[model samples]
Target chain A: MTLGQQILQQLINGISLGSVYALIALGYTMVYGIIRLINFAHGEVFMIGAFVGYFIITLFKLPFILALIFAMIFCALLGIFMERLAYKPLRDAPRIAALMTAVGLSIFFQNLMVYLKWIGASPKAFPRVIEITRFEVIENVYLTSDKILTLGVALVLMLALQYVVHKTKMGKAMRAVSQDKDAAQLMGINVDSTISFTFALGSALAAAGGILYAVSYGKIIYNMGTMPGLKAFVSAVLGGIGSIPGAVAGGMLLGITENAVSAAGMSMLRDAVAFAILILILLIKPTGIFGKNTREKV
Target chain B: MKFRSLIKMGVVFAVGFVLHLLIKVGFINGYYDHILTKICMFIIAAVSLNLINGICGQFSIGHAGFMAVGAYTAAIFTKNPDLFIPAAIAGMPRFFIALAIGGSVAAFVGFLVGLPTLRLRGDYLAITTLGFGEIIRVLLLNWKFVGGASGYFGIKPYANFLSVYILAVITVVVLSNFIASSYGRACIAIREDEVAAETMGINTTKYKIIAFVLAAFFAGIAGGIYAHLMQAIMPRDFSFLVSIDILLMVVLGGLGSTSGSIVAAIFLTIVTESLRRFQSLRVIIYSLVLIFIMIFRPQGLLGNQEFSTPMLKEKIRLLFNRTKSGKGHTSTEGTE
Candidate 1:
């Protein structure tokens, strides 16, 4: 393929990968928006979701859509339990304390899975759930069915999230709580439940992202969530941590940049490039692309 | 004050001599000797990290990056004979010089990194430091001169339990002294409240950078010892996880407490070493302990208090009194 065509092809690949990151980034953005705590365990939640989906397909002989749905439900419950058990008690604690708890929970989950022998340290091949077909988009550029499906599912979920956050009463409650917890509580909004719901929603999206990631990569492993989770977090921070649309944009931008670097035959620098962009954005624009700078008050 | 410090130095030397004799007699054994060396290295790293994250309240998670810089710089210096230093100044003296060079370079890099990133606060500062760390690791991975991804090898083994123990003792003494100084109080002030500290005419940024540079210097020394101990070094040796491990030591020891960092480092290192047979269970227990500690006692095991005989006696008395009274009793030891 010519350079332009190759670039186009890489763009297509990047978008598919970017959508997965967008899905995971949504969870991080949403959680940070509400609690102002970086849920480090959110990555492990993604890893568990992949395992759940894999089990649903391989053990129960379920269809791909059913596995995805079940994984979402399971992870939604897990997210709620995780919040109630680990985070709710520390609502009034220092931010650093909560962050440490999240780190602890992340380590706990990763190791727990290994100890239980649910997933060994080695990578497992994800059973093929979708038939992939290539279609020529241009003279030299082509698209795969898997890529199309990934994009389709991600777009639908994002739109659904947008609708929930914008139009639904629960979303309104979430917005109120995030805006001012005391005021919302005084206004009769159930702040605790809203936070739990936010965790559930974010975790559900991460679950879908996990399954899609496993499907794309064709394998699942115990510690698979660390890098992707980190990148998606970088995406969340890049797009402005609290903004939904920003997460989408950041994920896409990160994915594209990473792909472009790889296409230049420097695949090893992919992780480095993501971090470089993060540091630059943090230094130059601490508030990120869509973030509104708020002055600190005593 | 000078006499007291001299006595302290004499005590340190006595301890080092005893340990060295034990190692020589094979009573410590090679395995335990290795573990002791590691404990010393971790104490240095943890104490340095506490200076930045605990005393200064900077929340830096990229400490391992500075450690890497020191390790690679020291390794390169000792491995390449072409660098200027008289061959007559070989052995222990030369190794100490290499460590000093490594530490100085790390401190300079710390100045460079801290100047720009220290302006941000809390989690933003954290992410930025983490970014710098990953960038450093990536750069090292791509640099073929340092052996790239495979790692550099065949450095002289200059580090031993005695040297490392002496350095570790010096690290604690110097840092504790620094913390007791006026500059140390300024760091504590910054940690407590940056705006209030600034209002009090403290140069918050300058103090922050100073703490950061000092912390990096000690971490570099620790890294130099680590490189010499292992006789080989890899980029992956100083990854984000290593930073987290050091952070764990700081937190578990109780932030802002040098004695706490030392105690935590020794305790966790021994625990980890003993549980090396059950890796997954070890990590699980560690996580559980961390979570429970955060939930029940976010101040950490020492809770910003130093380990002392009087404090120990007070704690024991409090425990007995609480049991006798059958009511809750809170100790106000470290509150002041």
Candidate 2:
């Protein structure tokens, strides 16, 4: 391949990579938006979702559509249960406690995967649902079957998420709770249910991301979530952690920038992109793009 | 008052001496001795970690990074200690001098890291620190001059049971003294409320930096000892898992309690080694233990209190009157 073509392929790969980040960031952004708590375990949920997806196909021999649904449903419930069991009780505790709880729970889930060898310690091969030979989409431009599927799935889910957030009663409740939990409760929005729903929705999105992640990477490992999770977190922070659209923007921007940087012969620069962006955005506009920046109360 | 505290230390020292003799003459075993050495190392790590977690009140998740920094720096220096040890021993004693320099170097790095990121709170701070740790691991892995991913080899073994216990004891004492000092109180105040601490004229930033630097220093010294004991060091030895293991000791030991860290470190390290018998079930069971602790005993094995006699009495009374017990009384209390 020519230098220009290789650079183009790398950019395409970055965008494709960026799309998954946007999906996971949606989870981080929404939860932080409503609860003001960063669910560090969310990434682990993504990992679990990938495992679920793998099992659905490999163990149950389920169809692609069914596997995706099962994974999403499985992860959604897991997310809800996590909130109910671990997070809800510690609501009144210090933020540090919640943070610690998230870290502990994350460690728990990751180790569970490691110990059971549930999906096996090694990265399992993702089931091939699509196959296309290397073919030029345009003159000297080639696209793989995997990249198209990932982009298509990510875009579709994002739109669906937008619809739910903009047009549903649950969305209103979520917004109300995010705005003022006490007032939302007084207004009879069932604050508890809304929070649960938020977790469910966020987790489902993360699951979707997870499944797509497995599909795109063509392998699933016990530790597949750590780097991607961190990347999503950066995305959420970059676009203004609480804003949905901001997450998408942040994810895409991060993906493209990282790709361009790598094309410049610095593969190690990938993680630096997110941190540098976080530092810059935090210093300049700490609240983020769509976020109503608040300050530390004395 | 400090002199009086020093006198109290003298009595504790005698008791420690007796315990050491009993274990030594009584056969701690090569296997058990190995476990004890790790426990002692963990004790130092956990107590220092508490400086960040309990004292400064920041949820520091990147402790492994500092540990690695200390570990590698110590490994680098001690790799050829014969050249430096003689000159230092002729003057200020090689062991103490090398350990101090190792710790000081780690502390300086901690200061550099803490300055920019400490302002960020909670998980942001955590993930940032975690990233730093990963960066450190990769750096050590790729820095071929040191030893690359294979890690540096051939450090002379200077650490043994005696040095491990001595250093561990000194860490507990010095850290306890630190937390008991005005500097320590300022750290607690910052943890409780940074805004209020600042209002009270404590430079919150400065104190947080101090706590971080102190934690890094001890971790460095421990890493130094670890380098000598292990005789070879690798980047993998100080991954995020290493941080979590130390954190388990801290949380299980009751965050700010000095004796709690010592006891918990010893207990957990031994338990971890034993759990190795379960093979694959080891980490899973360990996770379950942590989860159970979070759900049922969020205050940890002893909460923020220590293994004092009065504490033992209160704990017994509380256990008996457990049904009548409440949250606030059980948690958030100082051991002393």
- Find the candidate with the highest lDDT and give its number: 1
| Cα lDDT for residue A269, candidate 1 | 86
lDDT (tens digit, per residue) of candidate 1 on B1-336? 778668767977998899889999999999899989999999999999999877887778788998999999988888876677666677788889889999999999888777766766656666666667777888899999999999999989899999899899989989998999999999999988888998899999889989999999998898998999999999999986678778889989998889999989999889888888998897788888878888888777678888765687777667756776633244333432
Off by over 4 Å in 2: A1-7, A134-138, A272-285, B1-7, B15-26, B80-96, B309-336
**Cand. 1 TM to true fold:** 0.93
lDDT of 2 by residue, A1-298 (tens): 7888887787788888899899999999999888878888889989999889888899999887788888899898999999999888877776777777787788778877877745557768988867755667666878887788888988999999988888999898899998889899999889888999999998998998899888877898887888788889888988888899999988888898888888888777666677677766655676677777576675
Best by DockQ: 1
Grade the docking of candidate 2: acceptable
Candidate 1's C-alpha runs over 4 A off are B1-6, B84-89, B108-116, B131-150, B309-336
Checking candidate 2 for backbone clashes, the offending pairs are none
The TM-score values for the models, in the order shown, are 0.93, 0.90
lDDT of 1 at A28: 94
Quote the true-contact fraction of every model. 0.71, 0.31
Q: What is the DockQ of each candidate?
A: 0.53, 0.37
